[model samples]
Target: MSSDLQGDGGPDRPHAQTEGPAPGAAPTPPARRRRNSYRSLTSRLLSADAWVDTALWRAGRTIGEGMRSYDRFLRRFEVRGFSRAAAELGSDGATFGLLGLLVLLTFAQPAFEATRNADWMTTEDFAVTFLDRFGKEVGRRGIVLNDTVPLEEIPDVLVKATLATEDRRFFEHFGIDIFGTSRAMVENLRARTVVQGGSSLTQQLAKNLFLSNERTLERKVKEAFLALWLEANLSKRQILKLYLDRAYMGGGVFGVTAASEFYFRKNVRELSLAESAMLAGLYKAPTKYAPHINLPAARARANEVLTNMVQSGFMTEGQVIGARRNPAIAVDRSQDQAPDFFLDWAFDEVKKLSRRNPALARDRIVTVRTTLDPALQRQAEQSVDSVLTEFGQARRTREAALVAMVPDGSVRAMVGGRDYGKSQFNRAVDALRQPGSSFKPFVYITAFLNGYSLASVVPDAPVSIGNWSPRNYSRGYAGPITLKEALTRSINTVPVRLSIAVGRPAIIATAYKMGITHELQNTVSLPLGASDVSVIDMTASYAAFANGGLKATPYAILEVRNSAGQILYDRSRNEPEPERILPADKVGELNDILINAVENGTGRRAMVDGVAVAGKTGTTSAYRDAWFVGYTGNFVSAVWFGNDDFSPTDRVTGGTLPALAWQKLMAYAHAGIELTPMPGVDPARLKPAQVARTGDGTPAATQPRILSTRTAEVLGRIGRSLDALGQTASAGEGVAQP
Candidate 1:
């Protein structure tokens, strides 16, 4: 009322026009002057008529009066009053009343343009779809979870709480409540916001079940007519049940029972008073009152609902106080069991694939082949289970996430969190965490590409740049260490010194080339992993090194064939071969250092039998997070462990949980496969030589790493670039270290 937030709901605002005066208020004109004018006009007319024909007019008036009296006398026997009208309808008046109301509403509702499809009148039968990846069913989607509870089965307190909070005069009124509407109007006027919906529960049900939510006069009028029709056709209990079953409860949830289970993990009948009130509060705005999203806001809304219930006489004041004091505990249902972490990740890709290809929709059942290897998925799951089971009790807050991809950028497995039901957030792809020392490889690799070497004597002593002094993770530094030794020890000051030497832009560019898509802050501490990134990118970047410097975009879907056996999409057919993003021989030097890191340094925990591998361990400041990124001949994997709330763990390091999990999973992934040397590395030169039964080993497990003939040419060019580095002056120019 103060401001027109309530104006026609035109693309600009969200309210309706001002409500008109109460029905039957303006019948005639203002009193005194209007009455005098009417009498003067009548008198003037009569005076003029008197001169024309007095005798003829008098005779016609007499006949007219006699006819009028006869007509009035005859009409006395017809149905004229409410009592007579009811008696005339015979028996079963409610039935006839309902029939009349339906007919009226059918005509009236359309005048307001608020009609619904026939299907809305009944329940919907939802369909389910499962996406298969690598001969395994990976994910399920599109199943509607709606179950109706009968009014009799619903708890009495819940019913009272709902009516009191939503519409107290539900049973008292025929369909609309004038007093409630008046109260809402006054409150809305006072608050200067649409603080209350002046609609009854029946009106709410009608709108929710069939109508659009555009606030306009026509919509309101249609809603009222539909409410009347519903009231006339269905019992009050039936209407209430329908409302409870169809209400939207946030996050694609619908209905009381489903919402009850979703929020509290309880049945409707078992809900406590405070729980019922909280649910009633959610009806106004589910997103605003979702306890899981914001507990305090939800509690405040529940208190307001309790006040309404007490004011409406549904509960006593004492009862309201007691309910507030003994509020029910909410469930911590953050994740689910079925889909796990990676399934949700892949399913998202499937949905996009479903949209792009027309044939995917032609069948009721669509078959999608993702790059996920079922064996690796199980290994990842088992690894997470193994580490958590062994170390979880002591540090119960810490949860683990893992992602594995082949050198060609095909994701084989991913575990987002400890439990998907408790939380669906994908930490591997969505979470942004400081990479810490895990990011050092990009700096070393950049330095190597810029003519530095694994044996480059990098200054590791503590130093200050202006007012900022960077320290190692152990708060101590080793002096004049080789770049490989610096990385192997996970030295923070050395990487920082190396970052400043190579230039932060060069380091950032190096990371970008290796598939880091997140924005990296151009700061001195960037080499110490001050910038945040997802695990998937880190894993994919390492895949570039595994595949001998080729740029690989990480992907999931392998093939999508419709039920008709017709091809819709195939990765090999649709996508072009990957291009190299780094020099092959230079990457070979970086790879040697990383492989040594795994075999002899901080990542020693990540080593497995029968293969030479490479990885790094990263422990952030204050033990906030831990990460381990490693790769083998066939696959690259990144693992992380931390609290979801970003709280510091109990001295957890990347070497402790993450490295061990990676070792177990990777060892299992290559159980029966022949040991093959990583690309860009000499098998005989690597520690404990990698020899495979197949003379021409497969670097991608099933596919060749250097597939295209053009890729071999690119490698040939990289080999020539390394040969030129020894003669160039750029190799001897030493940058000033901090």
Candidate 2:
């Protein structure tokens, strides 16, 4: 305010104004006063200029310093934030959380858990009946059960090879190796794809069990989390055990035990280092690296695993070199061609059982011992091939289905088609077609059960219903014939008349009791197989007659075990209930009539050389379907031949292709089995025929009833002449008098 306390040089120099103030006016009244005024003005101007310049310079310097500090702080903060975020992303906590989420998600879905319930099976443990129905699907192969081996029992080679190929730091890592993960990340980034996984054996097991193989950040997070959780919950040895049991190997082999049997037909403990390396190589892609498909690639991968083992100090260099020089490991390809159909069926059963009891459906290995006789299965397949080939050569028919079963409802062999590999459509279980006259047995049996004996007479002449007249296959009736003869000949009119006599509902009920669960039409024509039924159902229903009067449901699996050799379910017959729907005597009678059918009826072609067989032939309208369902003393076989499109086949009768196929199949089935006689009705209980005579033993004016074959022959000649003349044969109008 005062310029250094008004020290402006302290007025030391002369005031240099030098202006002539008013000229000479008063020698300037007091030079001191003027000087003071001038000094005040100068001080005010200097103070104002100094204040403005100093304030501006200080404001500019402050702003520049603030901007520089802010820029430096922002760069440092950003760098630290990014590094923290990356570190957190790779932390154990984050990995564990991710894995926990994946486990929860996997358990949330039914399909993932459903695969666990699939029934497993070995080559034995099946009954002859089961073998007959599904044997063809099995062939002559055996399935080894998946069993856990102790650490000591596991081959050192396998242990070392897997460690070398899958995780070099398996022993050191807690669950995941940070270095391996970083390397994997770098490799993945460079390759622009997920071509590398640095997951340890534990991590891989975690991913397989809890996380999907999907490549995503969220999935990786989940995998990491699960890996940590698995490590915490399970010890290293336990994790390795799980890894060995759950890992996939080539040729449909799922675990180390399965792989050993699949590749070398030996136990897991018996594998050499080279063999272990070969099996370890299958982890990359089991089917792709299967010895059966690509031997060279498999061998190369095995050698690489061996080399890695040597480098990892698990194997000596000489051993690696020796393994590399060894010839390609030989594997039996025959074992690989297992019966897929049986496997599928067993899997279905396993699923059903598991669904019924969910405790057996999770985290357990299951082995199913089924009723599959490999010998019978092979014979069944060969029979199918032979029959199909015979028919194919004659008539380009490439499709056929056959089902063989024991009378106790055990399916032995089933061939859905010629080539199961080309197409997996199981025609035996899926295809539905008309049963044709093969269903007539039920109708006649219904009549027999309803008081009409086998000796009862039925007119096979032209018969008419309300605007619907049924004719015989031969177009001409055999005249008055015995019920036995009518059925043996498969006369349509006799069955139609018999169905009318014994209500249609009675036949339907009988058929249903025999395992014909398919919906049948409530019409008069149902006696001739107007309803659609699957081959399996038809064969099973007929098998009821073979097994006396008790009905047995067809089943394939006897027991199921998990991958850990734990029994998940057992379908054994401790005390199987009998579903009795028919009288034993009636069944026996029906059995007798059916036996006669094969012995001397339309199904005569189904007879084997030395076996007493009984069955029925069915020919539908327009030749749309043909079937032959027959049974030996111990087995029942059903053969169906037709076009898949439901189109008519040219002149393909049930007695033709289907009957021949049944014959060929039965020949193989009865090769070693002995034939037994069917039980028949007691003759003493049957009432003798009542013959009415007119004058001189001539026929009476009443109904000229033809009861026996002798009388039927006389009536048939007269009926043919009368039918030829276009005149209806009235009762008691025989040409020759008796």
Q: How many residue pairs clash in each candidate?
A: 10, 34
lDDT of each: 0.75, 0.70
lDDT of 1 by residue, 1-738 (tens): 445553454433324424543355554446866898999999999988886688778889999999999999978876768867686676567788889778766756563343444434443322223343424455433323334456787877788888988899999987888899999999999999998889999999888866777888667777888888788878898788888877777543567777777788898879888898888888888877777766788888888888988888878999789888877567764443344466556656766666566556434344565666565676687778778888876975468889998788888788888755345578888899998889989998898888899888988897777788987767886788998888888887777777777799999998898899999999777888889999999999999889999998888776665555455777768878898789988888888888888878888777766677798888888788899999988779999999888898888888878888888777666655555588767888444533222211222132222223234335534764675675464556684433
Error of 2 at 297 (Å): 15
The count of residue-pair clashes in candidate 1 stands at 10
Name the TM-score of candidate 1.
Answer: 0.55
- Residue 455, candidate 2: C-alpha displacement in angstroms: 1.7
Poorest 10 consecutive residues of model 2 by lDDT? 123-132
Q: Which candidate has the highest TM-score of all?
A: 1
